[model samples]
Target: MKITKLTNNISLKRQLEGGNEEQLKTVRNVLQDVRENGDEALRKYSEMWDGIKLDDFRVSQEEIEEAVANFDEQLKQDLEEAAANIRYYHEAQKRDGYKLPLANGSWLAQRIIPLDAVGLYVPGGSAAYPSSVLMNVIPAQVAGVERIVITSPAGKDGKLPAAVLVAASILGVNEIYKVGGAQAIAALAYGTETIAPVDKITGPGNIYVALAKREVFGEVAIDMIAGPSEIAVLADDSAYADEVAADLLSQAEHDALACAVLITTSEKLANEVAEEVEKQLRELPREAIARKSIENFGHIYIAESMEQAIEAVNSLAPEHLEVVTENAESDAEKIRHAGAIFVGRYSSEPVGDYFAGTNHVLPTNSTARFASGLNVDDFIKRSNVVYYSEQTWQESAPKIARLARMEGLEGHARAVESRGWTKGDK
Candidate 1:
């Protein structure tokens, strides 16, 4: 990692930009093929990509039980504990439909309805995340979604990762499928003979998965077009260089395009963190990937003051922001745009990623500027409830008709007038 002086914000902005048009084109073709051919296309693509041919894509109850039996006792306990924490946290987020009484004797409310079915896409192959299973499923369960299905690629052996299955089973998610990539997303969005269509799809994958989610957005609701994982550490002299380096490396190791940034007021701390990042990179198992990420997108900026540092952080709108300063909590308040904010050095990014009960599926790149992380809200829809008393309608009809007429919606005006309330009646 190199320490650079903070200058043009645009330069930093350009580093976070991602998504390849070439990959999107491929993803589009895959989605189209699956849309047209459904199950046959899914099987062909599965064989082409995963080197496996499947007569049936759905994971059986026997398979789920085998996965549970095969998993180590300690790992199962950890998953259960993590699931408990996640479920408990999200249960608090569970909300009910609300009604409000208006002064005009009208009633307005919102019905918070959970989706009937939800599809969770978990990455397989080199990137199998059981933690993602827990993070994605728990919220949907809490939101009262009746059917929660998971789609992941199978290996050459045609078996899902035992850990992934174990986590899903722990959450009582029985509908598991052996499909992945853009094809799997298309299956969830459009449905096939084998896999039923879902109301929404949520989780993370590579560029293909992200582009697929973007393509299938309207046909089936999707959580977000997640980009590469990223983390921004806002540190001062009070922050530990080694810990900062470790946190940065954690995200960097995720992908060659993953971003790890540090914006600090102290130039000394910046240089120390850069050196510490390099030292830590030497020992990481995924050093090649982390080094490339650090070389390509990672940066350490020296800000003139704490205000300037916070300005840089908000401008970047990173997915994960860590405030490691003298008053970490106070400094965290200044952050306006970030997917998740971690305060203090001990509250590292991984704590939130796995066991802290916070959803790890966060808005990535700069989308945190407007979007939010996956939660129960993502799995539910809100329908506005409106009721008006005859008196209220009578009193408001002329005004409503006049507004409707202004918009050239005479039919709307007439509809409002049809209830025996006319223009100038009030």
Candidate 2:
């Protein structure tokens, strides 16, 4: 990892804005073709990209059951454990409807209603991520969404991963489609003969999927315009260099574009961590991707003090933040912006990703400053309600009329006047 000094007045817009307009245009073309051609377009893309020729685009319940039975028992147990932890965390996020009564013969309240349907897109090209299935679907289930649909591509054998199917079934998401990439996003955003349109879509995919979500925003709701995964570690002299190096590499393994930055008050620890990263990089299965990510985006910034390190962290607004200092919890408390904060050496990235009982689907590309991770609230809507009796309306009419007239809304004033008010002298 390269050590770089921090500068003032840096343009974050240059850092956060997405890359490769040509790739975005390619995604746009795929979305348009799918919108016009429907299932046939999905089949062609699946064959072209994944090398799988599918007779049916949707997975049947029987297939799911067989998958669940045939899957490795130990992996199945691990998934169930992860699912239980996820459900336990998100179940607390489920909100109940509430009502408030006004002193004046009126009632005001909000109703929390779940979306009628939701779509979850899980990437399938590079690896099978059953953890994603649990992370995305369990929240919707806890939120009481009625219909949940899942989309993923088939392998060259034209079979969905057993772990993916088992995870979906465990989460009670029965609707599974084999379409992937931008076409899957289109299928979820706009319904076809086979796939039903959903009110909202959630999940992470390639740049094409991100661009497609940006294009279909008004037509259907999307979770967020997520970019590559990023993690920032705030370390001090007490931090272990090898552990810091491993955590950085964990995020770097995501993709070549992922960022793993360290903001440290101790230059000695920073130099040691760089050496540790070089030592550990030789053993990783995805060393090529991790090395590229570390080479391009990873950096160590030496800070004069802990406060300056924190200032650097807030400016970055990283998706995942790990604080390892003399007092890690105290350092974590000082943080104001981060999608998720993991404190101490024991709290690593994969713990949150797999079994730490927190949502791992977090905001990326500095969006932690404004946005948040996936939660039960993302699957539900709250509608405001107001009820007023005739007496309350009569009491407030003059004020309403005056405000409306002051704003040059004569029609609104007349509407109040027509409610049986006598003409008044001003």
Candidate 3:
């Protein structure tokens, strides 16, 4: 890991920018092909990207049952527990429609409607993320989204992972498809013979999937354009160096572009964490990827004080923030921007990633400054409901016309005038 003294803020801000034009162009072509060719494009792109040809894109009920039947019982139990926790947390986030009464016998309200259908894209092949299945699907279920479909790349054997299938099945999501990448996104957006178009698409994938989401955003609602995973640990002298190192490496293993940073007041603790990260990286199964991530984007910034450390954390606005200091909770309160905060040494990031009931699909690449993590709100839409009685319209007509005419919109003003009042009468 590289160690640097805290200096320029621009250097930190520049890393947050995600995506490139070349990647966007490739994704655009894939989306266009899928939009024009439909199912044929899905098959062709599946063979090209996933190295397999498929006769059917949707996973059959029998396939889902078989996967669940063959899955490990212990793991299934664990997933069920995680799913329950996830559901419990997100259920509290479910919102109800609200109505407000007006003075002139009129009413203003908002109707919170669940999306008609939703598409969940889970990365497949070598990576199997049943946890991601729980994190993404359970919230939509809580939001009352009825038609939840999942699209994942098939393995060389032309099958989705048993864990992913079982998780989906457990969540009562039966619409699983054997497709992935930009083509899968395009198919979900535009629909094919086998796959129906969805109102929204949510989940994380590679660069192609990210860019595809960017292109199809207007056509269909999307969760967010997620970037590589990142973590920033705010530690002081009281922090455990070994645990801090392990937490940093946890996100670093996600991708080569993933960033793991540490901001601390104690230089001695920083050096200890740097050494521990080096030592621990050797034992990780994904050491090569973690090592590259640590070498390239990993940083240890030495702050003169805790206030400076907190300032650096806010500037970075990382996807995950771990506060390991005296009174970790108080220090965490000082942090204004972070997708999720794990307080103290015992509260590791993976707890939220797996079973702590919090959503792991967080805002990455410094989007924590404004955007938020996935939740029930992502699967629902809010529409304003307005009602105006004849008396209400008559009372407000003159004011409405004056305001509309002030903007030189004669048609708008006349429309308001037609309600009850004329321009000369006002």
Each model's lDDT comes to 0.90, 0.88, 0.90
User: What lDDT does candidate 3 reach at residue 164?
Assistant: 94
TM-score of 2: 0.94
Query: TM-score for each prediction?
Result: 0.95, 0.94, 0.95
**What global local distance difference test value does model 2 have?**
0.88
Question: 324 in model 1: Cα distance from truth in Å?
Answer: 1.3
1-426 per-residue lDDT for model 3 (tens digits): 777788646356435446688888888899999889999999998888889989988898999999989989999999999999999999999889999999878999999999999999999868899988899899998999889999999999999999999998888888899999999999999998888899999999988888899889899999998888899999999988999999999999999888999998989989999999999999999999999899989999998778878988999999999999997999999998999999988999999999989999999877899999999999988999999987898888889989998999999988877655434544
User: Candidate 1: lDDT over CA atoms?
Assistant: 0.90
Over the stretch 318-371, how does candidate 1's per-residue lDDT look in tens digits? 999999999999999989999999999799999999998988899887888899
The TM-score, computed over Cα atoms with residue i paired to residue i, of candidate 3 is 0.95
Clashing pairs in 3: none
Give the Å shift of residue 159 in candidate 3. Answer: 0.5
